[model samples]
Target: MSWIVDRIRPREAPSFSRPLALLVAGALFLENLDGTVLQTAAPAVAQEFEVAPEGVSPAIVGYLLAVAVAIPVAGWVAERFGTRRTFLVSVAGFTAASVACALAPNLLWLCAFRIVQGVAGAMMIPVGRIAVLRSVRPTDLLAAMAYLTWPSLIAPVIAPFLGGVITDVLGWRWIFVLNVPIGMALAVGGALLVPRAEHRIRTPLDRWGYLLTAGTVVCLTGGVELLRDGRPWLVATLLLLSVTLAAAAAHGMTRREHPLFVPEVLRIRTFRAGNLSGSVYRLVITGAPFLFVLLFQAGFGWSAAAAGAMVTAVFAGNLGIKPLTTPIIRLLGFRRTLVWSIVAGGASLLAFAGVHASTPVPAIAVLLVFSGAVRSIGFSAYNTVMFADVPRDLLPAANGLSATLQQVGTALGVAAAAAAAGLGTGIAGPEAVELGYRLAFVPLAGLLVIPLVGALRLPAAAGGHATARR
Candidate 1:
């Protein structure tokens, strides 16, 4: 791992070197771009494939599920192979998968391609992050992370607008096609700028462990899908399977010499608490946007363009609030920031239940903007605090575990929203849709209570070094 650190680090700070910053920034941009660009194109893709809009959602499910399955092994792969090789391979695979997705003839084929794309996409963020952490000094780490965060936060904000424009002008295929040039540029930049690591560890691949973890994630995600589809019996069975797989995976990890995730990290109260809270927090945060799209379009009779445009409020608020996040954390501290964020986020979501066609556009926009800002503050702080208590030695494993859970939370959030929207059979058209959105937010808002409690476990100050050693 230290060898990875040495190789992935830049020789000097990149402030003086334009090419280096651009290369890293470009990689980060592509990572965020792929994460969000598909959402705006979903409806168009559904039309092209001649399926229900809900059917196109599987494309998202497949991608996230693939990411969840692949992320755990990413650090291990980097340790065994080297960061440069793994990164290059991941980019190539992602680019090829994007091409395949653009050319896919049917929904099934597109979903398959998306799964491949997801697996490839999963590698970019973590591997790039590892490279960034290794390349920069500790003092510069926050700034480097901020550089990467800019794209991830901004992409989702502008993605809807960009995707809508592309779909309207160039057709939905262009959405995936756009990645071709971006991916190519990033791959070239990475090859040139990122250093190759010499210290390679010969870690044994945990095949059984991998299967168990993968099975658990798949079954859990699939179970959520089934529940949303209203298959009560199947949902129950799948849930049971998911639980069994998770238990087996946990057992396997404990017994193995080199588990996929080190058990010791879980022993740290802050790490464990932070991860649990963050997962629930992410479920609500990620899921809410997807629900908002459906609500605005299907429920309120808004056009795709108009609905997509309104989403810009989130981006605006996110950007506006970022500068204040750290200061707010310093003032209120992490625990207060996290708890209040969850409370504010849940209240904002519940407020959406009152939105109607008669509601003023500006008022609705303000609410969305507020929600986005509060959420950004909460989530960024949660992610930051999780790593605070982690020792340097456990960073890789913790990162892998946290990344996987982040994807899982995202998938689960979307799934939960889907299930909630699926309720109410009698009402049709916009009324039914509005009811679904309303019902969905109720439970989602309630789930925020979990994280509100979880935040209490975070230390008042960073003085729990002894606690972390447990």
Candidate 2:
């Protein structure tokens, strides 16, 4: 998330180099892929667990929520513990956790292992980036940073298709089992190649900030999950409490001596605009994939293999658009690029309603691919605008805040989509889950409106600083 992007500043050039950088990037790729691959396998996993496909979402949402909770502390933990130790431990823990996930006997067990995976992931990414920041020279910083950045772009494209293949050809379990080798390789490579720096003078732990922020995420995610449980009063209470806790957390952060995210970062006009818009953007785009996979397998009755294979069209879009992202943003400028991208994304989601059981395969592929390209462009622009205007001293905290909010928004998006589908299923009666899938897109597409309007409000020359450098 923002943690990965935020850490790659132009550091003092190190003789330490890109091998170490690539190794760290490899670790991140595995981490990012782990989060996304689950979407393609959710319907299949649901069958294995004897639950609704939407029911599998708690495991997905739980993992992301755990990552979101753990991310704010990663820098502190890495600094206190040393990046090498933390990174090594994280890779080991994540690999072990993936094994447990593959071996899980029930949904609860699976969700628990995923939470562990998320924690390890939270450690792996920031620590890895911290390692690169310390070791890479200023001259090599761009290449090193680009290596780390690729995972965010590459993983989402291939995860579903790859997850589908692994699930269909091997089993759903192997999709998780696949992480072991990658993690092992990264761990070994990291041990041998990564530089070991002495611990810094560590910052005091922000105990109050940690508790408030973690509590806010937990209660909000719990509230969202409870919405589908058919308990009206409980849902209302949890949601109300989540909002209350969020306000309290905001207050706690502002008053703290050393806040997790400095209060002033939010006051930066460009950062504020980017964060708010990015949240809504991620919520819709990230959640739609979860719903789409479910719709393909559970609703339209496609085989897991078929659904996975076909969904590669979206992956294709993500891949094809990457090289063009910077160029497009530079030429169009941030505001225009973002506004048009959001429009394209919103249109694509709206068009998904036309994808029927009888729709041609090629047509579906084209739609997903085009949508994917549009979404990618918007994401790239938002990430660029995020830190573009922050003063150098505040960049780190601003990046951390951006990363935290990114995960939270993504997790919430997935939850919202699933919960919407669940509620629609209930309203439409049994054997009508497909209708729920279609209805869920209404809100998913609607979320783009927030980012669209936000992007429009930005100055025409927003992100000029970042774009000029690119």
Top TM-score prediction, candidate number = 1
Q: Write the per-residue lDDT of candidate 1 for residues 1-470, one digit (tens) a residue.
A: 98898787766544223455556667656655666678778878999889987778778778888888998888889888888888889999999999999999999999999999999888876776666655343334334445555565566567767888899999988888888988898888888877764577789988888898899999999998787565789989988999998898898899999898887888876677668778988888877876777788877888878888998898788889988876676677667888899999999999987788778999999998999899888876776666666777777787788878877886787787767666522233444666666666777788888888888766676322221210
User: lDDT for each of the candidates?
Assistant: 0.77, 0.78
The local distance difference test score of model 1 is: 0.77
- Model 2: lDDT of residue 290: 67
The Cα error of candidate 1 at residue 206, in Å, is 0.8
Measured over all alpha carbons after superposition, the RMSD of each candidate to the real structure, in angstroms, is 6.1, 5.7
Error of 2 at 441 (Å): 1.5
Give residue 322's lDDT in candidate 2 (0 to 100). 78
Question: Could you tally the backbone clashes for each prediction?
Answer: 2, 5
lDDT of 2 at 198: 79
Error of 2 at 322 (Å): 0.9
lDDT of 1 at 195: 77
Q: What is the lDDT of residue 140 in candidate 1?
A: 40
lDDT tens string, model 2, 404-424? 787778677667777877866
